[model samples]
Target: MATLLHQITIDAPASRIWEMLTSRLGLQAWWDGTVSIAGGDCWRLSSDDLESPVTLKVVEEEPDKSLEWLCVQGDPDWENTLVLWTLEKAKRGFTIRLEHRDWRLSEIDLAAENTRWGERLMKLRLQCHHNDDLPVNDDDLSVWT
Candidate 1:
């Protein structure tokens, strides 16, 4: 089993980033629109562009700093697995560390996911910096807070 870890530094404050992490609209902006954290377990996670119903769980949540979820009942091979988003405070901005701890099928898969997330993280920072909600990223990267 291999773990894929990736981190991005955002030009946004820790608290500002936290709101986007816990809010519904914020979750949809980056994580895809298929989220219902406060709605409870078995939250649907289907993308607006995809035609499948995804099931996920909010395994844990820490105020303004962290949010963790289990994809497909936390099954690694199932793809959704364990996704953790952590926010670390810095002198200028905050570092958003995202990890998908799982048995990776290939290094390319890991790299691709991280690269894509890197772009999204950049988008997140840009959107937040402008105080805008339009992410323009496919995944949305902001669904709940």
Candidate 2:
């Protein structure tokens, strides 16, 4: 039950960042290609290789500022674990602060996950600010040595 926070800054506007955070369709690209937010409240996450019947709830939301949610039903340990994404516009670019509460993880896994997050945030900025028209080369598969 430790809170793990990570910060990622990208050269994109708050609106664009919000879209990638909230929209189901947009999230699919980065979140292993399976993201669903249905009935205006629920969050359904699944992977093509490891699908499950779990759904989360949106607890609070503020456009271009913050988005928070927690798993209300399945996976007790993961349930009620909150994900708070806060965005702040900077003089140069934008800063995204992620505060993950009530989530437990091993130190090695934590470092790996956060590194992946940083990479994804960088891709988000590139897709949003640089060129949405051009396709991104997303074939860099995750392989641990």
Candidate 3:
């Protein structure tokens, strides 16, 4: 399995970043998906790219420090995969470390997911720092529209 990692320091408090990581509204803003708390320790993330809702189980949550999730249901391609987000104090404010791991797929698929997540993180950074909701490009407007 392969892992993709991304790290960025945002100009925001850990509390704010944590909220954006854990809350439905915050996730929807950055992910450009239909996000809902399915129940305790579970969330449903739906997007046009997926044929069905993906149920993610909260694997770990460390307040303002870190959060991890395991994909429990939905697309076969994403099944059994993991996503982790870690936050740390930084000079600018806080640093976000993101990982999408356990890829049992083709290189092309993995690359696509990597790019998609990078774009999402950029939006997340913009939102936390400037409260901006504009898309980064015309083709990506669907994400913020």
What's the TM-score of each model vs. the native? 0.71, 0.73, 0.87
Candidate 2: residue 121 Cα off by (Å): 3.0
lDDT of 3 by residue, 1-145 (tens): 9998999999998877876777666677788778877766778898877778899988888788988899999988778889999998998899899998898978998888888889999999987885543344332221212
Please give the lDDT score at residue 128 for candidate 1: 62
Candidate 3 colliding pairs: none
Clashes of each: 21, 0, 0
Question: Candidate 3: where are CA atoms >4 Å away?
Answer: 131-145
Model 1 lDDT tens row, 22-121: 5555655666446654244445555543345555667787777888877764223445567788988877788889877764558776666566567667
Evaluate residue 2 in candidate 2 and report its C-alpha lDDT on the 0 to 100 scale. Answer: 70
In model 1, what is the error at residue 58, expressed in angstroms? 1.1
Q: Measured by TM-score, how close is model 3 to the native structure?
A: 0.87
Off-target runs (Cα >4 Å) in candidate 2 are 48-54, 75-77, 133-145
lDDT of 1: 0.64
